[model samples]
Target chain A: MEMDSGERFIVPPVNVRETADQIIVEAEMPGIDKNRLEIMLKEKDLFILGRRAKEEPSMGDPVWQEIPHYDFRRVFALGDHVNRSSIHASFDNGVLTLRIAKAEEAKPKKIEVAFA
Target chain B: MQLIRRNRNTTPDLGGLERLQRELSDFFDWTTSAYPTPFRTFGLLEGAWSPALDLYEDKDSLRVVVELPGLKKDEFEATVHGDTLVIQGERKSESEQKKENFYRVERIYGQFHRAVTLPTPVDASKVKASYKDGVLEVILPKKEETKPKQIPVTIQSE
Candidate 1:
């Protein structure tokens, strides 16, 4: 059984980067394991979800506690340049990293300068 | 706990009444325990949050776990000073940025430190730390004297 303090739905910090070949999205979701993390892509949106068990009281009373247990649900709008099928993900040190390679058509091309 | 800021002037939400209520308990506020440095905690500013920490002890060890996402293994360091455990780290933003490219920035940067006075004595030398999945785990084994002792008593049958 879980008690709902009405304190849920956290927006974890996210960083989006555009490299020459791929778009890298990294989200900070500490204390969550791979099993609890859910990543989904729907059309132009990428959704990341994670659930963390509530913070329980330990053996002794706490002198001060400012943090409440939180679950994470964050979404990012993905551009058409990304190839959704080739997306790769890895979780490490509480950070979730997702790499979506850019489609060949999206890669920039330098037109050769024709000498007149 | 004391909170220290250079100059604490921030612009409030412009979304009026509805936004005001949401902003009031906004979890992104800097004091939201995601940023655990500068000696104070629980500050509430829009879109600002700090890392949260948990400290608990078992019969043989005291554990300190910090939720530090988006940080590298070398970014954090933990040490024992006197009877206290000190953790210091820095999160450097990977992007220098084109300014306009950012949709939203909630992750915190700069150096942060937390010095916790351990509940009891611990074997300082044996303290171990590991960083994985953005969480830093510090296991401090309790000192010999601090471990619970079991004493036997003579049976008294009258």
Candidate 2:
């Protein structure tokens, strides 16, 4: 759902993890459409912004509301060792996943032990 | 090599009451590790998390829309139990295939249960539910008497 940006409220919750080959960043963002999401990569910093689709006001009395609506914004400082060109992103369920591949030289290398 | 890892794992370096809280999580309490705030886990424990819900009655039916992002249709169970509409599901944690270090953690993962007491009696058999883009919408047709009636008045002119 495409929507003109509304008020930015809270930073969506996220879990970031690094591995030998890639760094995975997962953000919990429900009610956000892929068309309204923005991902930016600059230098060594990565920016993620998501906007919750505006709910069309319907005719009816609201019975219950526990979830407050809000947009999502977060920034992460990636290191110079990350491969900028290989970054990948996909959204599923209500979570956004961003995979930042590491530079070739940054991957963990196992040294073979030799006994003479 | 300096390995700088700032992660809030299942077991962190916390002592005293915080440690007690963690233990409570093991028992009946489930504090979504990544939630910035803490849910008291001492008495009756709330499920790991409860998705936000909106229930309303329209002209023809009662509608319910629940927020449960990242969950596949099969991952959640939604049904009307007695007078309550129950939605329950689990948010799986990302796999630890070849993890090195984590920089930040905030998302909460685990099981969740949300039950809303339906206000009006509805036709249980006609309930329809659909899950898309992490949202669940359930529509229940209202009973005959419960529906709003429109009475038209005939013009009485001499």
Candidate 3:
């Protein structure tokens, strides 16, 4: 990819899996701290941002060079069946996992058959 | 003499130190011209990206711990290049079936680079790095110059 000034450095890669009740989103965000991560749901979109604090040297004479030290931002558009109000997220070991349940009315239900 | 003329020409009106600072800053900017744009943006908060590292210092050595989850050990490579310690790694995405439907996707991937400048010079020849349970630990022994020294105090009654 061509390097652009406006482009963000960190773009999280996500995987989406679904079950009968909910959708699971697993995002790989290595080298990111959980405390710096923010997750929010607005309408049918999910926004995720994570920031990593920089480290200052303690002893040696200082040297200068460029390093990455900014917040990571990503947004995802959700589907209509996704129940935004019940969405939940957790960050562990640099990975952000989100659980979004499907609306009750959207789930498949079984019906009993009567013999005539 | 020629030496006095050179000194006068190089020195600024502000002060010798101020002139040197300006010259040094300019040199740094020129040398980093090859850096990518994102690198420059992130460098604005130099040493402010990663949180305060939890350091465990003992008499013999110091251990620094950083949290790096979802990254496999083989995916990361750490090296000491000059005064900078570089951590370069890639988080690959899991393969997906062509027929799979993605309702929502939110994850980050691609190359990641983290360069940490050691507070005190470390014994790069004997450094150790290990990752376990989502944490990366780097052990660096203090160089001879930065090592602590013991000073004895003699008690005298006057």
Which candidate achieves the best TM-score against the true structure?
2
Candidate 1 C-alpha lDDT tens digits along B1-158: 22211222222323445545544545354345432112222224423334577777788888887777767778888889777887777776555534324444445665677667788899998998887667787888989998999989999999
TM-score of each: 0.67, 0.74, 0.46
Cα lDDT computed for each candidate against the true fold: 0.67, 0.69, 0.58
Ranking by lDDT: 2, 1, 3
- In the order shown, the candidates' DockQ scores are 0.32, 0.48, 0.16
If chain B of candidate 2 is superposed on the true chain B, what is its TM-score? 0.63
lDDT of 3 at B13: 30
Writing each residue's lDDT as its tens digit, candidate 3 over A1-116 gives 22245655555546677777888877756566677678876655677777665663342321322223455666667878878888888877667888889899877788889999
Fraction of reference contacts reproduced per prediction? Answer: 0.40, 0.72, 0.27
Q: Which candidate is the best by DockQ?
A: 2
Give the lDDT of residue B147 in candidate 2: 84
The segments of candidate 1 whose C-alpha lies over 4 angstroms from its true place after superposition are A1-7, A52-68, A103-106, B1-50, B96-104, B148-158
| lDDT at position B129, candidate 1 | 87
lDDT by residue for model 2 over B1-158, one digit each (tens)? 11111122232234557757655664442223222222333222332455678877877888888888778767788888767777777767554444357765556556767677788888888999987667788998888888888989999999
Candidate 1 lDDT over A1-116, as tens digits, reads 12234555666666666777877777778878777888887767677877775453453444334444567766666777778899899988777888889999998787999999
lDDT of 2: 0.69
